[model samples]
Target: MLALSAWAAASSRAWAQAPMEPHERDLYEAARREGQVTWYSAQYSADTSEAIGRAFTERYPGVRCSVVRSTSQVAFQRLSQDQRAGVAQCDVFASSNGGHYIQLKRQNRLTQFRPVNADGMLPMLRTADPDNYFQYSSLGIYLLGHNTNMVSDAEAPKSWADVLDPKWKDKLAVGHPGFSGAIGIWALQMRSMFGPDFLRRFERNKPQVGRSSIDPVTMMTAGERAVGVAVPSASTLFAASRGNPLKLIYPTEGVVAVPAPSAIMSNAPNPNAAKLFMEFNTGPALSRITRTMFSESLRPDVPPPEGCRPLDQVTLLSPSLEDADRGVPELREQWRDIFGV
Candidate 1:
């Protein structure tokens, strides 16, 4: 009986001693010594990016998170310039364009590191970057929006086609596909769903075209526009949560799902910090922050914010990775011709 008890104790100790994933202490220790992580993120508004950076720093305590927020194209342009100059200022890159990862991976610009947390993410999100050079960090949805003070619930636009009514003419706002990556994807999806003549007709509404996805929500909040085209759901959620008169319409045709991707630079100045930041970006910590902004989390475990619908429950007009790569550029030129932007 004593020998049997000794064997049982030995087996339990061996099982407990088996090697496991890297501990948070190891990551934090290396990240602490590295000091900071610079993030060039075009995933959300500048303020949102800053808030997330603050949260990351607060969680890690010793490491700093420096955020350079801009539209996805602008962010990518700056990162490209940094690469050309051979200066590694950005530790992580977050862009709204999923195709950017494919381009970066092909160019050997991305450092591959698959986060263990990624295994817990939704299957579709995990496949966003097959090469593991980047990960699907968030979902940016293009939703129809209206001012509750100006448009009644019954009168609010329910579909992309509904925005074309003469009633909404001069009372609509839209983002320019040329300036915003999310808008570019939206333009492509709209073209595919509504046919080529759609935007031409939508143009007659005389939408107040702005350069950012948040423009429509801004217009709606101020009661300047009764309805908005291509308004980001995140902006609408934030506005509604603040008791603003903004409301989102996830068109019956489906809200456009723009998958944002994040990656570490191959020559990151602080690789350890970059890896840790990547884990945090996909982990529950940042997901909670993003949830408030209306961006859908990739993790199944991260519940949607109060009064917000889960991604699985919502009808999303999601384009495959290949379609986005092939269609976005083509749609951009078409958008310019129709919107004359």
Candidate 2:
């Protein structure tokens, strides 16, 4: 009996001694140093960021994290401003624009540090830049949603072609292209799906343009507008939770998908902590809530929210990184002319 007890104890210890996944172990080690990593993200909801920040601190115990919330463009702008001022405040950046990532890389602002799990990423996602400067989330298509107060799901349109209907004329709400990456892709898709002539034609529809892309979601939810060209699934949920009647649709011809990407700041005061932040943000800690949040998870191992369309099955109107980089400037100018806003 004594020998058996000892063996049982040894087995339990052995089982407990099994190693953590590489990234988790790295996070643990980095956290032990008690350094700070500041994150720049457009994904700011006080509740969610706080919850995530608390969870991370609990998991690591030693590390400190500060989240600087702003729009993606704001994030980029701040990074530029911080560098110009010789003040290093942000240690990580997360955005949905590939064009921004490529530009940052070209400027030698990115650090060359690949995550341990990057080898598992899709080939199309791998840019082969020496630095794993950019890591992208799993792709998710933009959705057009209707205000339930203004229209029922039955009355709601199911396809992009429905967007041009006469009833929605001048009533369509869309975000500006120069700002929102996801909405910008909507512009790209419009250009590709319908051509430049479509923009001139779409103008007759007189989309009530919002300076920020998220305005469509806000206005539609408030019932100030009947429809929005595209809104984040998560943002829709955020509004829905507040009792807004927002019904979403994935256009039949398919909607454009924007890839959200994250990067560690090259001059991050704590490189190891920055690495840990990348690892933790991409892992189960952040991924598990994707369903509830109305967005897709970045991990291939994870599945989409229930009732959401399989992104693969949806018609892909997503722009290539190269094309988006080259095309956005000209297109934004065209949009300014169309709206004169």
Per-residue accuracy of model 2 over 1-341 as CA lDDT, tens digit each: 24433543453344235556866786668666856778886653444455456556656667877877665666777888998999877777876566777888888887777666555444444443445677764354577888888888888888877787777786688887766666666787778887777777777888888855578888897677898887766666667766778877888787677776777777877778878877666654454444445456555665665446766687767787767777776787888888796
**What is the Å distance of residue 80 in model 1 from its true position?**
1.9
Question: What are the clashing pairs of model 1?
Answer: none
In Å, residue 252's CA in model 2 sits off its true spot by 1.6
Clash counts for the predictions, in order: 0, 1
Q: Which sections of candidate 2 miss by over 4 Å?
A: 1-19, 31-34, 43-50, 119-131, 138-140
| lDDT for each residue of candidate 1 in 173-272, tens digit (9 for 90 to 100) | 9888777888888877877888888889888989899888888888888888888788877778777877898887878888888878899999999999
